[model samples]
Each structure stands twice: as C-alpha cells, then as structure tokens.
Target: MGCIASKPPIDFSADVNFEHFKLLRSVGRGAFGKVCIVLKRDTKKLYAMKYMNKEKCLQKRAIRNVFNERKILESLQHQFIVNLWFAFQDEEDLFFVVDLMLGGDLRYHAQRSGAFSEDRIRLYTAELMMALVYIHDRNIIHRDIKPDNILMDENGHVHLADFNVAASIRKGSLLYARAGTKPYMAPEILNKSGYNQSADWWSLGVCMYELLRGKHPFRGGTTEEMLEMIQSAPIKYPTTWSEPCISFLSGLLERDVTKRMTITSENVQEVLKHPFLASLDYDKLINKELVPSFVPDKDKVNCDAMYELEEMMLEDNPLHKKKQRLQKTTMSKQEQAKRETIGAELQRIAEKFTVYDRSKVKSTPDVALDTNIDDDEITSASPRPQRASGLAVFSNEHDSSHMSEDENALRGDSDSRRVRSQSTDPDPLELPTRLVTPVVDDGSSTSSPIQA
Candidate 1:
C-alpha cells in the first residue's frame, strides 16, 4: 500500500471587512476601540477582533502607530508572541484578528491567584525571557512589558501581546522616546536617558518580583514618590526567597544600564545561565516543552471582573451615538501620495493570507434581533454561547467613558495598575492617544513613556 499524507489544516481568509464575521459580546475595550469575540461565518473559527474606528484614530493622530503595529506584527512569528492572523481595513475601522487567548492576561490571573510560588514564577519568567530574547535578536524593543500585556493560553503558556508601542531599532542604536507602563519601566527610561533592549529586562524583573511578592518592589503613594523610590530605594527581597533568586533579580534590576544583566549581546546568555533559571532548558523552554505549574480553568475563559463587566455592558442599550464617517481633509499632494503608498502596502499584506469563499456566507438580515436582556429579569448565568450561525449585531461606537471605567476597575492598586498623565508633546500625530496618559502612580507628576 502507498503511504498516505495527512492533510494540512485549512487557513481561511476573508475580505478586509467586518461583514464576514459575526461579532459577539465585547471582551475588552481600550481608549480608541473595543475588542470583541468574533466568529468567522464560513469556518466557524473564533478570534478576538480588535476594531478601531478610523475617525477616532485619525482624530487622535494615531494612524501612524496603527500602521507601524501592523507592520511589526506581520513580520513576527514566534510561539511566545501573540500571532496576528489577519490585518484588514474598511472605510470605518481597522481590524486585527488575533489568536483568542482564553486564559486571560497575567494581571487577571495574578490578582485572582495571589502570590505565586517560586517554582511557578520561575516558569513564567523563563518563558518571558525566551520571548524577550526572540524580539531583542531582531533589534525590536517591546517598550511595553507588563502583566496585562502577557496573555495566558489554555495550556498555561503565556505569549507577549500589545505591540502598539514596539519599535524596530538598528544595530547599536538607542531609542530616546520614553514609552512603557510606569511601574515596570527601568530607571534609564524614567530618567529619559537613551535606553535599549536592557529596559525590557528590567520590566521582566519587575514582573517576577510582583508575581512572587504580590506587590511592586518600589512602592509609594504618589507617582513622584514611586519614581524617587525606583531611583533610590534598594530592591528588597522577601525573606522567603532563596539567595539564588535574589541574585537573579538583582542582576536584572541593576540601576546602571552598563551593569544590567542581558544588557549586552554576551551578557544575555550569562543572565540565562544564572542559578534562578537553572531548571529551565533554554532549547526546551523556547520549544515550549516545559509544562507550566498553573493552568487556568478552561471553562472560565473570562475572569470574574471581565465577565461581570461584559454582562453589565450587554444589558445596557448599545450607545446611540451616530457613526462618524471619515473624510480626507487638508492633505498636501505629497501627503496624499504617502497615504496611498501605505494603503497599498497594507492591502498587499492582507492579500497574502488565505482567501475565504464568501459565497458560503449567509446574508445579513434587514432587522437583526436585539439580544440585550433586562437586568432585573436575569437568572442563571450561562456560558458565553458559541453561535452556530447568525450574526450578533451590536453598535460599533467607541465608548471612551465606559472603557476608562472598566480599565480603572479591572486594575486595582496593585503593581498592575496603569495610571495616566497628560502628554508632554502637543502634537497628537507624533504619538498615539493612549501614550498621552503616562503610566504612573497616584497623583504624582512622574509619568512613564506613553505607548506610541
């Protein structure tokens, strides 16, 4: 008998339009857009579709950052990094369909589970180190590396997400733009000293510390006090931590960039060889052979806070704000050509993915049924349904007020809290709107680099 070949998994692609997917309940919301769980009609595959309004992005002058993020994501392919399955645009919005990380973000898990054991922290730290190594090798700096951006999958493995502020660097060059969540930011970044990939190492150290101790290493009631503490306070380790673990953190949290572990090409290898990560096999770790100590309950994909917020939002009437149609204005001939060039590049990238068969998709109904239920009539809480067919229509309005409230509530006073400060730069186009709020502590002037 002849040998038979197993068929490869089908990769379905669709047009750069929202019509192809049935939007479900909102999973998350950001400053300019909302993330929804969308099911592809033709293949029934689920994805977390990040929909950003074109007008809002334009108003905020964040279009460049959006394009840059798309470019970076398209080029990256790694197990520990969030995979961008598709990038498309319609007249009204830009859509990024990515892998649905059902296990939620590390911040949610850390808050729910409390302090993690050394063994568990070691596993997560090792995995994140591998992710950092991958990105640093390509001369890419993930300016933002915090608990919220580290998403866990069903198997308890974590992948780095949120590349909105990531920048590609040339060899031996340093980035001066201050960007990243405040608490996780390194001294060099906070001081506005030109920094490099070593900054991410500092962030990883902060994450490890928080996971083990349940609080940030540098603590203060205000942002200024926090920055002062970061610059001067000695990194105090818990009495329970072993000497090796303390040494490992000390290496990464070095205030002087020159002495920082993983600061140089040669030092990165040395950092990995430290006693704290002795149990991890670098090869196996990168290959994801090491099993995690904690796996989130698969049935509860959304955390309690997220689930509750989703329920509340779904019950409320969808925002009645009229959709703002975008129109090009005050564009010079040169600028117009530049926009066209970028558009063509994005279109080309979109076409590289698998093409979907649109004929199989069902037609949209004239009057979609409103699924919102009255809050008083609520009874048993059911699992989020995976609809076999039919679109769950909802408003695509960008509700900034609701999003701000949700973010504040989800992020308590722990190390994971993201505080915002006014932007120093007046030019909105030069930086994204999210970057305007410098991630910092309560009521202090110290601001972290805004996400560009």
Candidate 2:
C-alpha cells in the first residue's frame, strides 16, 4: 500500500481580507449563518466560506461556542476532518475559509442510495472512528456526530465537519453541556448526567444503525417522547445481520458509560479489535491506503437542497442593506456612550505617537529641529526614529515589553499600534449585555442537527 502524503501546513499567520474572495454562489445555510462557494482572486483557489452575522450570534448567546469552534479547528490537522485555512472577522460578520467538499455530506448520499451495504458501512465507520480517536486523544469531544456532519470529499473519503458544539475537557472531567441532536445523543446526555468523550461512540452507533437500517433504531415524534424512547427502547437488529455486526453495535450502543467500548483513550484499541472490523488493517486505513468501497460522483453536485436554500437566503440577506440603513439604524444610548469612550481614548493615544512606514522612507538630508517653527509642518526625518527593538512604535506612552517575540512577529506594527492605542479603554468588541438568559440546561432547545 502506498503511503498518502500529508497536506502542506497552512500559514496560520496569513491575514486574509474578505475583499480578496468573491462569492461564486451560495452552498449551504445554518442557524446563524450561510456558507458560499468563494473563489480567491489572487490564488484562484476554491474554498467554502462560512459567514455568520455577528448580531445574530450575539442574540443567540453563541459567541463563546463560535470562539471555541475556531480555536479547535485551527489546532486540528487530520485527513478525515475539514481543514480551516483562514479565519477573520469584520464589524458585521465572522468568516471561516475551509476546504470545499463538493461530494456533500453523508446524509445526502445515504438518501440517494437508500440503505448502504454492511461493507460500505464498515469502511465509513472505521474512517470516522479514526477521526474520533485523533480528536479524543487531544481531550476534544465532537458532541454532534450525525450523518449530516459527516462530509465526503471528491474521492469518497469521509471527513467529519462542524465543530460548533464540540467541547474540550480536562482529563477525567465530565461536561454537562446539553447540546447535540436528540436522536444521536447518548443516554447519559439525554438524562442530563455529565458525559465525557464516550458519548461520541453512542452517536457513531446511531449513525451506523441508520446507515444499515435506513432509519434510527429509536424513533419518536416529540423531543420528550424521543428522550423516553432512547432510555427505554431496545435496539432491534435485523435477523439477517451477522453475529459480529450485532456484537459491534451492542458494544457501542451500550447505555452504561462504564460498560461501553472506547470510553477513554486507553480503551480505543478494544474498539479496533471488534470482530466486525477484522478485515480492516488499522494502519493502512489510517494512512489512507485502503480503497473506499464507494466513491461519490464527482461530476454531479451531491446536494441540490443546500444550493436551493442558499439561493433563497442570498436574495433577502440583511447584510446587503447594512450600508444603506447605517444612519437610520443607530446604536442604543449605552452602546453609543461606550463607543465614544473608546474613540476618545484612541484619539488621545494617536496624538502622542507617530508610526513611520519603513518602505516609504526616502534618502534625504536630516533637517535640524527649529523650536520656533510649527512641529506639524516639518516632518522631522530624525534617523528613521530607530524602530523599537521589539516592534513597539509608541514612545514612552505604552509598554509592550511583556509581549512575547512570537506575538510581536504575528501582529503587523500598524495593527499592533492601533490595538495599543485603545489599550486603556475597555474592549470595544465586547458583546453587549443581553436580557435573554444563557442556555445552561436542556430547556433551551436548539435546531435539529439534521442538515437541510
């Protein structure tokens, strides 16, 4: 088997401006945002750009979740996970540039093919399990693992997408966050008992069951009824299924967390040793040497519903009218005061320091400073004002001695100077205090995890 070469490392320091990319067409939509197929003007590279309205995200109290998702995506590098190339934010929106998977998600392909064969299911399960192992090893839990979140690349390789609800926990710690789709949620999560990484195994079981049976093992019409069904219902397996297949499902779908296979990093090997997965060479599978049993049609678009929704959403997008109503839609009195305070502090800092662009400097004779002349008229060429050893531009007013060399290198002097200008003031980008209560429990129901 040939070893699959790893992708080149992405330049995390690269500052991407949204203006450099042109939106070709809408591809998908979610709770707080929409995704579009965008083309980079300079590189002509295609990427799926996810844009979220800042105001809407704030209203939903999902700001923390958004930040977490970005942090996790930036840190991860796996073949079976969607890679984040760039992340940036503007006044109105947050943007993420990720690899474009034209093959769409597993749910779309599943719907098109009806029930998948056991061999195909085994291949997908093995690939996804590898992804889970990689993340879980790092103490990250992908809370949602439904078919919709599992995307396929052009070569029919499955990649886990969407980390909005994922959480990272300390070793041996349990998370109490009640998030994820009801159908794929583990018994511990549904019961509001704290859950750990083992919960993802439960979701994988549900996903595998759906793929083989063409429906969820446990089903109900309402959320409450679904919760009850998950807790009480016995998972029925078709008599046609082999004993090894039934054993694998039983182990993963175990309600008791302690009894479940692959509860912690130490037990992951046990999952790989299951009889149903005996045919797979774990090393070759992880290295991408094993040929996939099925491959998606590269010429045909896999998801028509996503494109249709995007078309409808782009027509009435509120962001398009932001500039037109900028004057009319003014901030509240409190927000206005905060902005003024921030602006005043910035102005004061700007008056004290001047930043010189190195590239713009010209060879000219230095002029002696005359105390009688106005200081503004003559731009004193004083020995290029010796660039501060640490890229610090502000003279005597701000102290950047605490900043590390790596931090200084990542931030351009111009941007760093601007940030230092407002250092005395409170964060201007802080989310406003909302009247709505934050969701700490299961009372605040989120949208179904199923992709449209």
Residue 412 error for model 2, in Å?
Answer: 46
For each candidate in turn, the TM-score is: 0.67, 0.67
Which sections of candidate 2 miss by over 4 Å? Answer: 1-14, 263-270, 306-314, 318-452
- What stretches of model 1 exceed 4 Å from their correct place? 1-16, 263-270, 304-452
Worst 10 residues of 2 by lDDT: 413-422
Tens digit of lDDT per residue, candidate 2, span 1-452? Answer: 99999846445235565656655445555544667666665566777778776545534544444555666676676889987777766555678788888777777666556677888888898889888888887777888788778888878889998887676666777766456665677989868677888999999998898878777787665555666878888889999888988899898999998898774446555666788988888788888878888987654445543223323344444433434545466777986775565444234323421322212334211221111112242122221111222210111111122111233212211011000000111222322121011111222323232221
Using lDDT, give the best candidate's number: 2
Q: Candidate 2 has which clashing residue pairs, if any?
A: none
